[model samples]
Target: MPSGKGQGEPFKLEPFQKLFIRAVYEPQLKLRRVVRRAILSMARKNGKTALIAAIVLAHLVGPEAIVHGEIYSAANDRDQAAIVYKFARQMVDLDPELGQMIELVPSTKTMIARRTGSVYRAISAEAGTKHGYLPSLVIYDELAQAKNRDLYDVLDTSFGARDEPLFIVISTQSNDPEHIMSKLIDDGISGVDPAIVCHLYAADEECELGDEKQWHKANPALAKFRDYEDLATSIRKAIRMPAEEPKVRNLFLNQRVSPHASLISRAEWKACAGESKLQDGEEVYLSLDLSSTVDLTALMIGSVSDPCRIEPHFWKPRDKLIEHSSRDFGSGSHRYREWAEAGRLHDSPGKTINPEAVALFIAEMSQRYRIKGMAYDRWHMDYILREFDRIGLQAYEDCEKGGDGLRLVPWGQGYRDMGPAIDALELAVIERQLIHPNNPVLNWNMANAVATSDPAGNRKLDKDKARFRIDGAVALSMLLGLRARDRNIKPVDIEALIG
Candidate 1:
């Protein structure tokens, strides 16, 4: 409980605790910078919390401490935040000498030095909650589960103010690529750029994930404290679970399993690629990517079938080099009308469609079939949003609205949240819930689709820069919009609430 030496009291640090100390305070560490970022992926009972508490105490009470120093512990959940708090509390409870040196500030979840008034606090990762704080040191525990990326962004901004600020992000790798913790790991390993990152994951070769031996490599205290034997049994069941469920075990438990283990192979994906034919009584989902003068517009119609597939329903401007001929562009052509009338076509006309025209389109589609809500890229489709307001349509906004009718849908706000929206659409497709017409142009967009991951393990559509201009946002929005309309929900009134 009592961590660092308190008033000449006897003290000994754990191995990992000693490592944390050297990583942060060693003068040689500053000189070499051999490891600016490090991951300590120990097993569950490896005393990570206690070690972190000791480090926090070291920063607070160590001989070289700065007066009025500030330190923080951040986590994905409130419970995790409390772990750091509990650890600090334990240090005081175990040693009255240590307790005499520090005062617990109940109001702010902090431990304070009686002589200097330095402070340490615990924080949680909720929306718009992690700002306006500066700390000399930060310890992020169990970061792999962090759902919000904003917390990382806030800390990043704080780092620029002072070069000496110590930033430590630690976590058990989780399935979420979108999680702040996972992104840090991925960025550390990819070494795609100048930064050299450090990570000690279970070597895919050394241990069959879940094997106690394999898990121990990443965790130092596994032999004495971790429940590795029981975890091994669960790993087998996780491998057998469906696409999404098992990912949780693989990521957090450090198991090796493919979450997106598709029943269809690449060849099937290629063969099925534009071969989806619309049948009578089939419902189709439409995705629209609008364009301006330089950008090409796109619309995709995906199946609402068991194979859960998406293909392009339409594409624009056969070739960028070719002139905008009525024949090549197919503007005002019968083929365009055929799909347009079928309500399977999504169009973005290089600029925001006229408010009146969009309103008419939405209304017309709603009357024909359950026209679900539409999804558009908020970043690029500024004009479209204004048009929605001009027409008195409600869209979700994030703000302090005093009971205005505008309910802001938090999920529709950014590229980050768009990942979940796409996953939802994919699930709908796999469930055989969406239907669409097979259009040549739409097929083209689907063919060019690529996948990318952000630091937090979130999957995203990668629009190939060299190939055709494909807007997965547009496609995703169309699907979202359709789903929304079906649910009788309107886009949240972001302006009203956030403003």
Candidate 2:
């Protein structure tokens, strides 16, 4: 191993590095490698890339060497892939003894030890030519930045031929909680696989962001190899600009925080959680948000009286859940599955939401509770309206257009309507006038919501900017808007509305 601290000096392994090497090299009593896969997660400037380069070289021509051994350093892009390879080549060139033994091929980014018949190379996901290569040792550098799992799967599956294959992943925490790197970290934390070893250095969730102690916990080399002054400067900048806080925490604190700006404070949302169930005979207003057929469709019901109770019905395409559950960008579907199994979400059949099923659910809700009116967005109203028509429900015209009966109301999704609705809902939540059943699906959507302000200062939930589905939140806002209208109008005969 070569040191990054100085030129041509033997690398002095940190205590944590030594422990990792021991775990990988020291076989169990059964004479088998204890750890086949290792995941090392830490903040930047922690010598992660250099450490990974050293390990790659060790397997190439050191104690773990094998005849005709194939080792690779893989990353999301070509520049990232070259990082470890360049360091390894530099290490060998800096030392006379290692230089004499190894041959560096800069053009192809390869290092070959002719005597041992071992080779080290660098590859990236964009190359699209990773398949058909059997790798004995694989080092995935900055795996969090990878957009997909194609390269990861290719390299992982290619190792089955080797008797003692080793896969090492070194990366900083990703901003996306649903990313592949985050999934691996979650698995490592669970400790379900005996052959997998994980070392994660991160600040505690409750730790103050400005605390130096928390910074030291996440960055092991804070004052040493990593400059303390540089970090302090960044901390000061983050404090001055609220927009930079999430990026700083993700990169420096190694926390899996959401990259999206929050619409509501998490503390306030959690504070509003309580046991509030709706009664069968209670009069309720229904709101539906059908934004995407293949994505999430949300229906929210709220009681008319004080202590406004809410219940959410969420639907997603079942096939999409199966297709994306194992993907890196598919965290939403995985969570949906969990919520579905918990009986808090509904899984519609095929690749799109079943409008008939949604209509039937509304009919069932109408039978249980006296539904005053249902509010729906006008954009994708055709399918939903047809379903309602098939179910014998009348379409209510706009009150300004000479409408007097209770039916489905076409609610505009612009800033004018959503702005006031959001404000009212927020006030209700703060005043403890709005009660919910503490639904996890709805809670997740609320947490994923991000607010967007129009030029005139009106704000609404921005679906594009939200981290995940905000259909639930949008539905709730619509329900609040309908509730406002319900207070001014009289209820129509149930028989006439259903006919």
Listed in order, each prediction's TM-score against the native is 0.49, 0.78
Would you list the C-alpha lDDT of every candidate in the order shown? 0.52, 0.78
Q: Which stretches in model 2 have alpha-carbon errors above 4 Å?
A: 1-8, 22-29, 264-286, 292-295, 301-354, 368-375, 394-448, 454-458, 467-469, 476-499
**After best superposition, candidate 2 residue 198: deviation in angstroms?**
2.1
For candidate 1, lDDT tens digit of each residue in 1-499?
4432232344456565576556545644445334435555533445567667766787787753567778888877777787779767876767778789888876667888887778888887742454677777777887655544557667656755544566676666653332345557667667663333334444343244435555556555544444455555555665565344335345434532224432212222334333345444355455555566334554444444444344443323223322332232222224333444555444434333343454444434434433222444444456546666676655454344553433333234334655555455444443344433344344334434444657765555655321333454346445654454445543353225335
> Could you give candidate 2's per-residue lDDT for residues 1-499 as a string of tens digits?
4454554667777777787777667857477577788888888878887788788878877878889999999988988878778888878877788888888999988999879888888999888844788899998988887776778888988987898899999899776555668878889879898788888888876466689999988888787677798888888798898788777787888876667656655556767777678889898889989867787789998888887888888888888775645452532236557667888889897888888998888878877988778888877778876887798755565554554434677877788778777776776676677777778778767878888888977878887888767888999988986786556533223225325
* Model 1, runs deviating above 4 Å: 1-38, 41-45, 127-130, 190-197, 203-212, 236-248, 255-499
lDDT of 1 at 375: 47
Candidate number with greatest lDDT: 2
Candidate 2: clashing residue pairs, number: 0
